[model samples]
Target: MLRGVKREVCLSNLTLQHPRPYLFVTAQCDHRIFYGCWRVFWATYHVIWVLLSWVLEPWVLYSSSERVKWFIYLTNWTYLLLAVQAVTEAVNFFCVHSLREDIVADQQAVPMPWYLKLQWLLYNIVTTGSFMVTAWYWAVLYKSDTEIGAVRVSFHAVNSVYVLLNLFVTATPTRLLHFIYPVLFGVAYTLFSALYQLGGGTNIRGEPYIYRVTDWSRPWKTLLMSSLSNFLAIPFMHLLVFLLRLMVGRLWECWRGSGGSEEGETRRGRGRGVTCVDLGQRMTESSSIQAELLVSCE
Candidate 1:
């Protein structure tokens, strides 16, 4: 059970009176199937971009200097994280779905393993880094790639869109203070920059800094302003993600609510009134999905 949620919710009418039983057994199965497909599709789509990036400079993998670039390393890390998640999603679809069928409406509480919780933790970290890659790149370092079919323009630069798509699928309302995760990511990257400089390493173009926006060679005020703004942007972007989740997540709830109300009314006669709270109970199930893709069984 989650921290602030009720242990037992009374949805007697939804399960018994409703034609399509508004229950977790069927909803969780279908939710896992649909989200698994989306995760696989998103992962596979980005894998192409990862390959394109590697093909651009296969030598980078072996070169410490080239591979250490913020863009290169972060993108590689993001791809690996997403690919692993794709495999997990496949397991859920193929293996767990079959074994889980014995679960009925009454036995909705499923014990989650420690590994599953670890995966969710990794999911948050990888996703936060993924979105930052996109937001920072687009805002500070976007250039046209009209002539060359290189990795920078063709496939590797869509991290912003990829992150947004992931957020859309898994929009569980997170705690505001948890914004520290992304801030810590920024701090770690700053440490990497410090180490890179300490090691007498230079960026791909032989510049002292990884990105032009954070170059130490720039004027003092310029560098300070840019660095401060970029760091601050991390929290701002997280807030935006939170806001997006709240807006989109509510819409998802309302969608389920409206659908349930219409179906429930049709069954219980035209004069019947379906409360929003009653409809919300229909969405109660496994925390993996929450209100996001809890579709009707029928």
Candidate 2:
């Protein structure tokens, strides 16, 4: 059936292949001169800001009695993932740039690198996880803690902004099936919370729950919330990001302008989905574009 074939094709997109190296560094349109630099700058900035947050976290929780258990919370865990994502992205750009010549030399289609795959997985987790944490904290647990400090705001609020900005700008491909990563992340955290409860752990407030929604006292309620969060909320967030990416892609295409050349058509086809164009060719083209831009700027 056509439906079954289409389903298979859709699932194929989830595989960790076809991610052109240029996608990591360049924007979707890839026309702008400063786009790659701007992306690297954000990655570097995220690393610096996250490091600063780590330093300030201890001070922020100095007054709390169970401050040492900060890592037990979902918010902190998500923030830590965000930190990893930021570092991975920065390193990805470095590798891509450093090995540009090598990448361009090999005419074969190179599979997406392992580190790039890790970065992409982390991207899925933090994008949805950060937003989930922010939404849950603000909606359900806003007044539970009186700690309205910069650390709190940064973790619960600005984290979403950081990921959303990346989502809006990056050319990184998103697959419908990739929603499973963040869902698995949520499930893993949920299991950890349950185990923490079984171990007679207490929250910062000395309550036997990491989160009010995830409290084990009411097992059924916790199960419902956890299921909804992991299964429903994460998928919904992923869909929202996917839609946003599509819209951003359209805008980028519009800005890029149309061309009648075969190369232009190939470049434009990337917006539809991850195409299996020759990696070496793509990298060679990307390098040439960068060189041209540099010469123009000078």
Candidate 3:
């Protein structure tokens, strides 16, 4: 009688959450479909990267020596990484399907799935490889004396921490971070390119020449709007980099000279020379640091 009551209670509990089980089943089915489709998507992207490298080869050659080498390396590494990832993902998908069939056939004694291990491995490889490549690009910029200020540094630091934190916290899934990552990357690249172009040349007073459309005439509303957008975006994008520079400047001052000393002024001048050397060193070090971090993160 007790055993019968226990069975009835168990059945009642299971029935009580019918909607939740239904939702879970629906999600699992959708995920399985998405996983299958993603294999083709990965393959398509791998081919695209290869083709892009071939197309850009001529332009890469015509660029500066530093730029040419970096671009070529970036292209090669990107293609290799994507190709490998696609292969791994494909294998993982097949393993998952096979394991699911096995489980259905032998429901009384289900073995652990091979696909879970493969999925985890692929995730580590992709995330680490991507981060390393990004760091390598930055290192190239640094070695070229790109002069990334405190604002840019801080932004990167924050971005890195945020990504790592997401990885650590299961509660706030990394998918959320992945969704926003591309947008952040696009905006940062746009701003960085604009700033590099605008700040490339200098004038008599050593101030960057601000470009603006001064005309207030009619029938130029569309042009005016376009111009405004460009102007806003450029500054907004550069603001982070500029802030980084400000932070570096303050750090330099604090290191070289305490306030209000003649020796401080002398130290400041000396510090400038040291700063140039330090920047170069930091750039080289950053590349190695990035490589190490990527491995560690993985």
Local accuracy of candidate 2 as per-residue lDDT tens digits, 1-298:
1221133235555665543545655554554346646656766666676667657756365655465677898888898888878777776766676776443333235556788788888988898889898999898889865778777888898888877877766777665577889999999999999999999998877888888778899999899988988899899988777666645544444344333122434442432222233212222112221111111111
TM-score for each of the candidates: 0.63, 0.76, 0.31
Q: Name the candidate, 1 or 2, with the larger TM-score value.
A: 2
| Model 1 poorest ten-residue lDDT run | 13-22
lDDT for model 2, please: 0.66
Tens digits of per-residue lDDT for model 1, 1-298 = 1221222123321121212222211222235557657666766765666665666755456576565463525445555665565455445444444665433222324444343444444555555666766655566666666344555542345555665665566533333334566567566666665566657767776777666665545557544754574467766766566556544544444454456433432211222332344433433322223322233333
Q: For candidate 3, lDDT tens digit of each residue in 1-298?
A: 1221122223222211111111111111124466456555655655565555445434355435434433223224433544665556556556546655643232323433444433433443334334433453464334555565443342233323322332331111111112122234334433443453355632222333212221122226534543443344333333332233223433443344333223423301322323322433332211211111111111
Show where candidate 3 strays beyond 4 Å: 1-30, 59-75, 98-100, 103-119, 142-298
Candidate 3, residue 138: lDDT: 62
Q: Where's the lowest-lDDT run of ten residues in candidate 3? A: 289-298
Quote the positional error of residue 252 for candidate 3 in Å.
Answer: 45
Instruction: Give the whole-model CA lDDT for all candidates, comma-separated.
Output: 0.48, 0.66, 0.34
Ranking by TM-score: 2, 1, 3
How many pairs in model 1 have backbone atoms within 3 A of each other, for residues 3 or more apart or on separate chains, i.e. clashes?
0
Task: Using lDDT, give the best candidate's number.
Answer: 2
Cα-based RMSD of candidate 2: 8.8
